[model samples]
Target: MNVEIPYFARHQLSPGGTWISSRQKSLRTFKLADIGEGITECEIIRWAVKEQSAVQSFDPLCEVQSDKASVEITSPYDGVIKQFLVGEGEVAKVGQGLCLIEVAEDDTTHVESTETTGQSPVKTPVQVTHDVAEDTPTEAPPSVNVPLRKHPLDPTNDLSGTATTDHVLATPSVRHFARQHGVDLAAIAPGSGRDGRVEKKDVEAFISKVPVPDEVETASRQQEDVVVDLGRTRHGMWKAMVQSLEIPQFGYSTSLDLTRIHGLLPTLNAHIPAHFLPSASTPSSPRISHMVNPSALYPVPQPPSVPESGRFTKMTYLPFLLKTLAISMMEWPLFRASITPAPAQDTNKPTLTIRPTADLTLALSTPTGLYTPTIPSAQSFSLHALASRVTHLAYLGRQVPCGLTVKDMPRRGGTISVSNVGAIGKGEGASPVLVPGGGVAIVAIGRAKWVWDVSDEFYRPNDDGMEGERRLKIDVSWSVDHRVVEGAELAAFVETWRGWVENPERLIAVAT
Candidate 1:
């Protein structure tokens, strides 16, 4: 049932009937309002409201801490608070409601005696609804200038008055969030409720609180509106990233031998649990008979299966790929940089301004989802050091809740990406996706399969440490920003990756 609130403000939601209440809607649903100039997301760090607390409109609801700064959102209308949409430490996007309130209806008849005690003219709160004409959505509240002033005090007595900005009349918290977003405190009308305090509720009444009587709001008007499903924070991120297309892109691909990486699986299974296991899994855990008998039956004491992520201690392909990324990046310093659109470059797409550093971005795809966490720019060192870093990042990626099957992590802002399709048993020749955000190049790897030794023991020991000539096709696919790095430079990077993987010992030798 739609819980009828005594009064409701525009854009503010109440217990929205069944579809909402059954889902347990709150009385005052204060969604993320357009806080300050074009800010899309904020981190919800603390709540100013709690269950059953009495509240007035524009009262501070909670602190929405953002990347730039933190601001406490105020309640829009006078009401009693009931619930909140997000938890602490979680992030909320712009326009998403934060809390719920129950507006008390028609309180004009019951003004408290205290409200009448002051000679300061008691202005009645008139509720004006912005009705949508039949088939159109109402525009955001108008930005009218609301007049603010100090109360009339002993006019005849000469008293020393304090001098501060007009915002001094506003609550400290209100001024803080406002200042964090560059909102002019003087522009907001003073609270007529009591003591001229600028409560959170006043902030929500965009037009009513304007200093100038004519309600002419200065906010940009919308021509049309489209909903953002993942919220504007995610949308903003997506938009900001795509803007880098002015930087040119190029790609290169090559075949890679992984037989050596394959050889290490048996040992990995023996020592490591299944959790740490990469995409490929072997049925090595066969049931063995119990040597000791319990009562009348020989109960086999079974342990848990291998950890899904396997173990970090064991040598895996992650280390090898990581080492290659780091070692190769040393020669490509531009890749290691994070500053936007090389300083010397113009807005137009050009090939010359890119850096040479190989700031690596690892793109690992699993049954669960895709993850492309940065390997930090210019992270170059010996192969062993690279191995250490690779293992750490790989383990960290696995722990990311979004990286699992439920949520597919979005990958962006990486110079080079390494996606291991090999884990899913695909051996050789698989093309990975070119993540939209100017992601220049990507490397696809396949499973280490055995190849026949026809050409002078072609399948020699590579990185995974397995001996014996296991014939395997080396599958490596690379995509680049064709403008900056040429076809040959991309080729050279791959050639280096391939060479290191093939002569794993050479990497080890130099690293040592």
Candidate 2:
């Protein structure tokens, strides 16, 4: 009768009858795990570990960038990297193998074995053995067995016989630079970057080496087109512009006499509150005279300290123009109204939501993009306060990534929007476009210029015997949703605003 000895028992019963233990090496395919939030795939931006590199558990393996954010992938087990399944710039889907790692596994556990006997096979406890080698085929875990799709950016997946820019190894910014210069990245062979990766310097070198005829260069420059993805703010503008097509708009252009405000600006700037002035230039507070009765003095209360962000030492004509516009909007409620969608039951009759206060939106151009921040209840704010708010908005617009938030731009936007295009250009007028929900009206204020007032109403003999007086004037173009605002009403509204603008004293009388 022969009895089969268990593999574990045989190994344990050595020449000295002592137990022995061993660890086996196994190949594991490290897969890209789900990095939360409905993210299905991400592009491998950089690899921290290279092929054949040793790594420990929790060590960073690679960094991946998704549509939302960049995340770093880490090793799950202590192992030596065998091969990379995904290269840099290549996208890997969740559960897809990212790389193969050789890990050591202890095989000292007991397994059940059968021994052949005369009647039936008897079960015996034995050790499980594994024949894993360095070149052994690696099997992905069952959970990561899904078929891998060929990524478009993968070089091996390109079947085109010719090399194209898409197949070149370069970053998105490098590609953009190449595109802008009308240089074909595919033409720049043997790039200077590591692994022949094309770079901005390589593109510049290519351009410098290649010379073309002047006419050809001009023609190529005209033909070159670079595609850019619109930013968040610009994308919003695109959608609004598209919606603008649904509404009928009419434009009205006219001139405003800024002769009075021009003189008033210097006085306003000189009297800017100490709080609004820069710390270096802030004037010392005046002390009360001892001779005056304390009761008669009435202690002139100081205005609230202006935040550093909102401080401004100088005032421009824009604040006064905006304030007067707000006052006019108060008189003409239609200009202060926003169009609201009709009720589900009554789709034909769209309603107008009239806001009691004039919330003004300024079309501010920033480095990031165009932003329209609202100045709520513009009429209620004093001129100085309005100027400070404008300065604060301008400051916010200059920040990187923009500092304006939803609070600065609420869902319920202003009734009318103003764009001071004149600040950057010497344009006389502009036909501003009015988008739905942007407001009932939009106006572009052009650059102001000094001109002789030759009109019969204002013409006067000057000291030099000239028939007209030198006056400062600015051009303003208005575009309104014709569906809600008639041409006559818009003209009348401008006239009402002009009443406060031409006679600047009225603004001070009604100043809050």
Candidate 3:
């Protein structure tokens, strides 16, 4: 797992070098490909072939596990594996060399050189120390530079160059922090940790040294640092978060009265028929009611598979929220559109791509990471149908090795996203992130709480008949791309959405 490419081997064929003879030995370096969209790297689970092993094109080379799923990599050439640059149980970055292939040419006579006509020797110097404290200045160690040049196929000399990690050694948390601050890991001074791995403290130190403007000074902090290795999903999230900075976002917050939905849940939940219940004789039978018929208000092109029972046992306000949002997207085409930048050869002006149906992404959080699975053509699904899709997506995301696949996530993706921020805990609202390539807007659903309305005439609501006329409301936070959407339009959209939430009977009346 701790495989490091020898310095001599790595420099034998520099990027600028070329072969002398027509039958000269050629080395083909196989770099890891972008396995999935947005997947920057994957952990090498195991190697199917060893060094010096013969392999034909399309042969299984190794198996890799991304945070999303496990995938097998294949050989691209009919040659022997020269070396495994990345070993088993190590992370391999996209576009980085994974192994070297030695392609032998069919020639009998050829002359080799010693002084270097084809390749140039490279000498690299490395520095090592236990720690480098700001206050402590230690004497520099003696300099030792070695010139390395050797045939990559030769296995004679095992000269070691330096103790270095095959990949950047910072934890996931540190990587996220660095990306957030726009700090390049390669530009930072060598970390004091083992294998010269960068740590959270190093990033904090780097951030502290950055000079702030005199008018806008930041308070200094000396807090303990923590490092976390980001899983596959978290890494994907990190990349999305970094890309989000490019979007100019404008937010709008409004409170929706959930009093009607709160009162309607008990009735809807208790209306389950006997046929919908799982039979004792058929243990595998679906227990939840998946029978959702399309109506004039909400139509379904095709219903998603029936989800397992328990999640649908009780009705919640989420289904109603999804239903209303889908309807709103159908009316407002801008919210269901994405900006496609123009190509270099074309005009500089970008164009917008509008979707015909409302495809909504449900932002669900699990132990693994955040996943937003799109519910395609959401405008067609009844309340129960939408509820079924939400339950299934959440179940899939929580499964071990995550059952969600690339097919489940559309390339164009959903036009709008909804996050149940209230499920985690009580909060006024959250400024949800609209991932760059994800959707045009994202709305956060805050916890529903009881609030007293003081707008009533003095002592008006306190009448015996009108006693306890309090409002039950939830906060709705909207984040829209300013490049595509206007602030005034977002406010109007929220107001329209609030009308649906306040009138629960409208949803039921439209149900088949």
- Which candidate gets the maximum TM-score versus the true structure? 2
Model 3 over residues 158-230: C-alpha lDDT tens digits? Answer: 4254222213455444655788786776656367666666877898898899886554233222244646677
What is the per-residue lDDT of model 2 for residues 333-409, given as tens digits with 9 covering 90 to 100?
89889988999999999999999999999999987678888999999988889999999999888864456655686
Q: Relative to the true structure, how large is the alpha-carbon lDDT of every model? A: 0.51, 0.77, 0.69
TM of each candidate vs. truth:
0.43, 0.59, 0.56
**TM match of model 3 to true structure:** 0.56
Best by lDDT: 2
Candidate 2 positional error at 90, Å: 34
Q: Write the per-residue lDDT of candidate 1 for residues 1-512, one digit (tens) a residue.
A: 12222222322212321111111122445677544444587678678778778876456678764433345566666667767778886778887867656654422222222223533322233332222123212233354787533212212222235333342356444564565444564556456445555555665565455465333343322334644354323544466457645545454556667666556545543664434445465335544425534535665566434343433445656566666666666756554433344346566643333555455666654222344556544344433344445555555455412222111222335566677777777655765545445356667777655565545555466686755564556566766655545788777777766776666656545532
Deviating ranges (above 4 Å) for candidate 1: 1-106, 109-121, 124-251, 258-313, 334-339, 342-346, 349-358, 366-369, 377-413, 436-438, 453-470, 509-512
Range of the 10 consecutive residues with the lowest summed lDDT in candidate 3: 2-11
The clash number for model 3 is 2
